[model samples]
Target: METQEANTKKVVVEKKPLEKVCIICAKGSLEDVYATLVMANGAVMEGIETNVFFTFFGLDGITKKQMNRLHTATTGNPAMRMPGGIPFPTMLGGLPGVETAVSGMMRKQMEELDMPPVDEFLEMITAGGGTIYACKLAIDMFKLEKKDLSDEVEDIITIGQFYELCDGDRTQIIFT
Candidate 1:
């Protein structure tokens, strides 16, 4: 019995930690955009290989004309709070200019913490050995060319290609 237990213990394999992470950003809202950025940055900081694929409206976060001007999603966002510590009313979110105001407030708060803007964040991530990819289907659907994206975008690729990038024994895929 002791010999049999020893042989079974040798057959058990030790699991290794994740070595790579692939993040998919599919929403355009400020919160959604920041969530991807934070996770990708954190992964790179831990010496894990990181790649972020921006699809659908999330492409706005990497677009040159809209990167720094992205807006918050106030409607249906229960977590939103006003600057004065009051909860943001859902009805108020529909009023004209309310989204702009909320976006500005969110920007101000991020700035207060010395967080980089979207464009700068992309740069930082790329500089830290992370990669940014734009969805080819979204680019074609939106009639966007390569020039429409920020310079930090490493490539425009399909979902299949994105999967290939994450192909490995311990690659994690996260959708934001």
Candidate 2:
């Protein structure tokens, strides 16, 4: 019985190598920007080719002017907190200078935690061979010109063009 059991061996098969492409369409608040950067970095570290297509509010992270100015969620957003567990007063966020304060505090905390800024993280991914694109429709909708985006942006692409670019022999499409 021991000899029979030993003869019943299993064959371990190696995983097939696959190429993956990610299309990160970030369109949420600052948290979304952080999440997108983190995922993009992870993919790059794994040697997976990646592309980030920032549109709408997501573009804030790539905008030359607003990249560092993004604010934490306020208003009816339940995720935000003020000086303490005390709910962030909706009216306070509406005030002229409070948003900046909140955004600054958040940025400071993130820095102390050693997290890279969004733009810098994007740069790291690009340096690691990841691509970045700006959606043409979003640019037009926001009245943004190519000059308005960061120098790191590779190109402004229509959805069809982006799809064509991403299609390949052994690529998997991932939309985040």
Candidate 3:
């Protein structure tokens, strides 16, 4: 009986390798936009087919009028800091020009590191073979047209369409 039990074969289940990724960018702030770009770019570098769908305020990252002018979220961002690396006080965020100042500082630091602006980042991601899409409902809600979006945008698609693009055994979806 013991020998018979030892003869039983163990079946192994292996997960499929990640072949595609769908990233959802839902915020418009500088940090959020950069996060999405970095991840999408990284996915492409890993030889994964990637798609980035921008919805809600995330549309700002792909909009021609706002792409390069995204602001930092000051009100509730605990990670926000000053040039000296001091934590930014929440109360100071309410002062006029404070948000702009912080945003300028962040932009300068990013520039020092040779990070591209939002528009350029989008261009880079697309050039690297990643696709960018805008949420159709979001476009309607924001009163935006195709002409108002960056040329990098592949299309404005519904959520169902986005899901369809992500439909695959080895596809992963990330919501930022």
Query: TM-scores, in order shown?
Result: 0.89, 0.81, 0.89
Q: Which stretches of candidate 2 lie over 4 Å from their true place?
A: 1-18, 83-86, 168-176
Tell me which of candidates 1 and 2 scores higher on lDDT: 1
* lDDT (CA) per prediction: 0.93, 0.78, 0.92
Mind giving the per-residue lDDT tens digits that candidate 1 earns over 1-176?
99999999988967798899999999988888999998998899899999999999999999999989999878898888887779989999989999998898889989899888999989989999999999999999999999999999999999999989998989999999
Q: What tens-digit string does per-residue lDDT give for candidate 3 at 1-176?
A: 87666565333445567999999999999989999999999999899999999999999999999999889978788987776789889999978998988898888889899899988888989999999999999999999999999999999999999999998889999998
* Regions more than 4 Å wrong, model 3: 1-15
Q: What ranking emerges by TM-score with the best candidate at the front? A: 1, 3, 2
Q: Tell me how far the alpha carbon of residue 49 in candidate 2 is from the true structure, in angstroms, after superposition.
A: 0.7
Q: What C-alpha lDDT, on a 0 to 100 scale, does residue 97 get in candidate 1?
A: 97
Q: How many residue pairs collide in each prediction?
A: 0, 0, 0
lDDT of 2 by residue, 17-126 (tens): 65666566657567778888788777888898777788877888788888767777667777677666888778877888877788788889998998888778778889
The candidate 1 region of ten consecutive residues with least summed lDDT is 76-85
